[model samples]
Target chain A: MSDKPESLTQADESALMQLREEIDRLDTEILALISKRANCAMKVAEVKMKASGNAGAVFYRPEREAQVLTSVMDRNPGPLGNEDMAKLFREIMSACLALEKPMEVAYLGPEGTFTQQAALKHFGQWVKTKPMPAIDEVFREVEAGACNYGVVPVENSSEGIVNHTLDTFITSNIKICGEVELRIHHHLLAGPNTKHDKISRIYSHQQSLAQCRKWLDAHMPHAERIAVSSNAEAAKRVQGEWNSAAIAGELAASLYDLEIVESKIEDSPDNSTRFLIIGTEQVGPSSEDKTSLVVSMRNEPGALYHLLKPFNEFGVDMTRLETRPSMTGNWTYVFFIDFAGHCEDESAIKVINAIRETAVDVKVLGSYPKGVL
Target chain B: MSDKPESLTQADESALMQLREEIDRLDTEILALISKRANCAMKVAEVKMKASGNAGAVFYRPEREAQVLTSVMDRNPGPLGNEDMAKLFREIMSACLALEKPMEVAYLGPEGTFTQQAALKHFGQWVKTKPMPAIDEVFREVEAGACNYGVVPVENSSEGIVNHTLDTFITSNIKICGEVELRIHHHLLAGPNTKHDKISRIYSHQQSLAQCRKWLDAHMPHAERIAVSSNAEAAKRVQGEWNSAAIAGELAASLYDLEIVESKIEDSPDNSTRFLIIGTEQVGPSSEDKTSLVVSMRNEPGALYHLLKPFNEFGVDMTRLETRPSMTGNWTYVFFIDFAGHCEDESAIKVINAIRETAVDVKVLGSYPKGVL
Candidate 1:
């Protein structure tokens, strides 16, 4: 559409307008295609509901979505990178999925948090999201069928593991349906009432404070740094105080109608978080899948060494192992493992069997498709 | 010392007083033992200095520390679990290690963040601590030898991975020296000038807001929730306002002279975080050790499968695999893997060799001692 010759004279002015018109026409065509796709998804949902004999049916197929995302990335003839291309497709699919059955996702929230961002990034904007107070509440809502799924932060590269979520997995029967990662960026925000020059205090979550430590030390040395529960809460606090500023992300700043005094205040640009989708139904294997497990071993020397023997013997590719305190057994630690292959895979099953033989206990948290966005 | 005869009612009072005296005596004995231990560590440091021909020497031995922690847990004969026992011993060792050279450590900080807590927990109160603004700076400080060691959060169970730290690993040559875990707790606090009845807004980090969502919804539903940079920052902000309350941890509350209005506000009782110790030198194998690596492969179908083959072949207990954008490659994803056994172990070396044969590139992110606290 942008096929105008370079170094053209005034004669090309009319042609430039024509090119823009061509772009507009193509955009309309794209919208038409999207509407058609959304219709197709609704039609598919009808079939799925009929198959299950009810309205409450598993409309979100992790495997199918994963396959679609993989296909999109594989086939993209993009000027953009594969991951970015996949992300665009993910949103399109998410919108179409919403047309079929709007997803109800529960997330850890007092409105704005990284977990909420992860949820939107993974599920897209078309779905209905409810903020749950805690990680456990997110799990419980999904388990009790209040929401189709729940989003929760599982670990942070800088923070290590969320032990509460790991502990929840020990007792809950919820499945891990999908996963998403979001890059974290913190900003320094202030309210409409605040005198910027007289700003004597700063508010933020502990992580954000740590993240922006150098920036604050250099720019606002006299400002007393205060820790809060979250960035969103900090944005709210600034609304009532003129001599106060809050360090948060774009989400909280926008949510509280605060102005960014400084942007990207996070010390490290690589700050990112990962979130998991928890649901009641077991997700089928995707083209490239990952399985999570909580494995327990007897308290003895070499127990950890022995517990992991099965993966090697059975050729199962283990991905992650986290040690959390076991609740009922003298506080011995349990390992949370993520590995390649789904639970239903033949090799994965064999590995599970081998682990069960020697391990004190084992729980397959879920097998979910790898993150495509 | 607690063993006084148990049957007589009136005599039990005297026995109880005797028990109290015994506890005091035991405490003094413990202080003396700790002093002696510190002296021993100092003597070792002197000997090391002599061995190294003066000023600078490698006084911190990760392998030795890991072994000591492991032994402490193994030999613990108590109602206190292995973790509690290890934690107590961890502080003891940290104190002793500090006496050797008064270890200088840097962490993401404003003093009250969990990273700071982790630093103190890992290095003991005797060490000289500094706060870095970002995870990368923590790495840089250690790389530049400006600090003896740097502590950063690598992953969180609830939030997944801190990509910034992982990204730092991709470019920096800093070694992973040790790991520590800390349980997290959040509290709602107000300062002296705060109006308890007129708190129309609550402030916290986004994570903390989410952690306490349910409680806020029920108790202070009308209070506008705001997010901030850190919980500590929120505490400071609340001090200058009467209509605001901040949610933070105990450390933050005390640091800014705030009183806790509500305690244990987190939704999950098991909230916790993990931190990593980064230093310049490669860590030797500990009694029970773990190693981490950043592995790259040609972007292809089943690339992950091929990449993980080595761990299975060598029976190395693979623990973690995080995918991040490869710094110099064609923007394909790279995997960060953590597994049982240190880099020096024969089996671990075999796994590394096998991986090297197939991998496009591999970076040995220094092996470290497991978390003792």
Candidate 2:
């Protein structure tokens, strides 16, 4: 109706104004409905917490949220597409969950790191954030009740598992309450004073620099590369320097007042990072869920196959399988497997028992509702 | 030796130089081994392609890379922590993959958009890149064979599926060969000459601005928010204006010579986008894999349960289950499921047949191997 090309015909203009007024009115109604929906989510969170017997259970259900948003999007109509509509609801739910119980989460410091991003995605703005200097510190904070939960990088789509996270799991008593997967995008950031000709050095967390290996090789082959503790830290060091740049996330650029010399500088465009949320409680079951376990096997050629045989025989599906070196023995390894089905299911229980009998040690890393996103 | 204190009387400058040379020599040897290892991956890729019938199979495997890097970290005595060590290996492998095969992919244009970043992560620098004006154009380019593959946003870990992508899937025969999930970080960028106080409008893709909802509410509550087609387009529009600022990716900032006024502006730090790699042929099995399918259910009270009964009874695991509006009928829905096995597996085939019998129609979208990341 607004597309009519008449040069402000009096009748057309008034009709257009009236239609706009009606749209504004409907938008206000939608805002109210959205507020109501958020409030309902708070109630849902409260019920979930009471049922699960865990105060922090309200946050981080990747699988559940995925299902919820999918249903919402399926039923949505009009100018807004399903994705657009779902995004609006995701924010609403995030805000609602925040209201249910505010959480405090800790991650490796400073800010704008992928780990920090993962924590936010899982917990939303409802949680307060504490940036720790190290992964161990994040664990300690959660263990000491300084934060409700801790987030640490477990793996990257391009780089693989963050070994520190896996090693920490081997030692820490903290449960893997939840997990969040994030896509990692690295940028080459420099200070406003930096001149392309004067640039001679690049700084970043070794991971960031590594992810952009090819880009560096092709574009800045002569520049010296230095590694730092975190991408944010690298950006901080490069601030006001004309001869240096830092490879980091956009947040680092803003946090350190740096300018982007280049963006999405990672070696691969589809790079992603997966993080684990450590806390004191296990997640209760939803309509769908996933269970993670760590199994140790003797140093033998067929040991890995023997452990996996039962899963195949029982028709249990394994989603993710990775082997980490066992700290206790030479050449020994701990295999971490994520499979469908809650631990409470009969088939899941049978498979776990079977694997446990064949393996030296089996650690159930906690069974949580799978995240939707 | 590098960590030895100067307390040793024999520790001299020349001794340090000699030690540095030795370390450098070892590094060269390590580089050669890495190069050799990378070459082997091409052979492995060849085997995989022959087995799976996909031409572009040689790429970085996140899980295997993680496992290998974790081993190195665990074995290190550590002047560097495990995190640092693993990070270095991640880059090494990423570089190796770049050598094996360069990829070229297409995404919605212009440069500095998150989709561009997503394309980079999946294809790396091994392939050429082409930017399309619309989502449909991306598919058309891939269809016309202008690019080997196309990367388009399928879903967000937090926000749900991109409906445009889903709608495209409905009409197009392109198979989803692989999937990449990326974490998105948005920034408020301005020209160096732009004054923060004078900024009157903020321009960005509507989706990006929405992702930063909370931040905008808290900071620029009154600033006029304008929607554009893409982040790069927003950046392009703000080139000479001192009163206008753009919220976009770091690439946009650099591409347009804009200063980042605020970074990591997304409400949740862990904002991630998931993309699908569309190609003519289905992907082959990897050491790690996931299979996606779409099944239609009759509109009944317990239709979902009936449809899922086969998976449960057959002990098949469903990783993801999403419902979409069916175009053929009113109130009927199509379910998208991601499971743990390739469609070729005996049990998977049985389950597919059973699901088809129970549902009105079942479309096996593609049963490709799961991503290693």
Candidate 3:
């Protein structure tokens, strides 16, 4: 493919071809802008290191990220929605962050799990991500300072909450530094040797299995349904046998070089999952931010009212609140809350202090920028 | 296995055998009690049928079920925890309910998904559970009167929220009648014909794959990781293959009759998921109740603050408050909330009325009993 624009024949100069030339010119400009942004990121890293007085510097800034994304959405004059535009910028920032410092992330994984997809989505492909089998190990690796940060699924719109991640915060001091949201789409896949009509078994993760329950029952009611660790693993298994198929996502389908027998097989068209970023230090305020905390209270009338009154009085917006069985004692309960505004915000601080006054104990999980994409 | 009272010499009876006899007697007594309970349920059904003026009647009572579970916990005096005691009673209550009217439940499934286990855990095996492929279909079946209720996952503690279920509620008028929490434990499984020493591939759901990433990296670093729909499906595929293993739960391993090469292989010890029950009618007050709702507000600063002020003023304790992207429009947001009392309660009514006064629109999902098991 030659880069020279040597030909301008009459046919090549048609209106459609002329429009294509403009599109190609715009693409060239976009690439140049990206390269320039990367160089700027390197300079930004240098400034951060000089300010911190060391080569080992904290270059990632959650507040700044929030501000950037919010600004992009606020000013977008586009055919695309704010979320779509923000997603495009998200990749740009991810690449820039890689230049500043290649982030090392630990996530619950076997390479093809949704958690891994979340890691890549949040940090981009530039980060070095290690998959830990358990959520606790992700916390451990982050806790031991082996990884810069850890990613864990905190909730699913369909599934409710991941108690393990919340429970981890009860015993560990990891900060909630960022958040990611992933759209869950399941696919029915098979290997090269498989006989499509003779497929006798299908495998997938529990959530995926549930997501595709309708499709499977209609197409392969008699096939053995097996719940595996991840969709990627299922795709791998089908490779060895002729009568097996897997229901996984795009990653797994590609990871195993499998064929997609069916796509978008999940029951809900809008299935999505939210994940959290955990680290040691707390984050500051952004244009819009969310702070999470866990609070415990004794069983009594108005106990919950007492815990929430301060936020109401302080006019702090509550984003999410959930109850979990208290790990410390019987007949005791704990609540996990997420609200708009960083913990460093004045109103949030007041509400937090007020909660501490009535709560048996309170842990400020962290304040992070809202999920922009 | 003959049960006969044989002569036992003073020194002939071992402590274990003596204790076993006592346990056997208790079990017999328990069976008698259960039989009596079942008979009472039959009489209750007859009364309900008479009251309804026919043999056909709706027998499941979410409020009454909650009250019974609460009472069981209150009166429990044993070495076992309240939760443990309530679990045993949950099954008993489920059995009794079956005698009155067998319940039919729809869940996201392929037989061995966690949602299936949750359905059984909440309703007991006496109820007929139809595995539907999608969360929406579960709602559809219940709405169409094909099933008494639908059990769809609303959230997971570790995973945060299930967006599809929440969004479905936005469109469909299903009431949240009850909830169930399940502890998730994953295991490594293999078929009998597999060569244990030379495993080159692994299969599992994406989440489970991530959950066991570290273990696999350490043990089988070279094995190709594959993602699947469900662990049960993975196990099924492994049954016919010799060089593969699946990571799934105990249910899948048993259902597929696979050998457990590793048990409790998940990294986190307390990974659990929470699920919600959806039905047509709103449940009344229970011994321990939680009410869920949805409210929309205008896009403005402190929109969330205005919505929560009433709950605080009325002294209503909100158990949960989550923000959802409004399905109706851009920039507008909605909140899903769970609180301490039924909508019929005095304080809760005040809060609801106050919220209605300012909010653009509101929908009360339901008020049901807190999960006792």
lDDT, candidate 1, A131-232, per-residue tens: 665789898898898999899888764344677888898888988889988876678889867778899999988878898999998899999999887776
Each prediction's DockQ against the real complex: 0.01, 0.01, 0.01
Best by TM-score: 1
All candidates in order of TM-score, best leading? 1, 3, 2
Off by over 4 Å in 2: A1-12, A31-66, A78-83, A144-146, A156-160, A189-247, A250-259, B1-373
Evaluate model 1 with DockQ and give the value.
Answer: 0.01
lDDT of 2: 0.68
lDDT of 2 by residue, B316-341 (tens): 89998888898878867888888987
Query: Residue B176 in model 3: shift from native, Å?
Result: 54
Q: What is candidate 2's lDDT per residue for A105-169, written digit by digit as tens?
A: 99875554567767766765335776676788898898898787899888864345677777877
Compute the interface RMSD for each candidate structure: 33.4, 28.1, 35.5
Against the hidden reference, what TM-scores do the models get?
Answer: 0.45, 0.44, 0.44
* All candidates in order of lDDT, best leading: 3, 1, 2
Recovered fraction of real interface contacts per model: 0.00, 0.00, 0.00
Residue A277 accuracy (lDDT) in model 2: 83
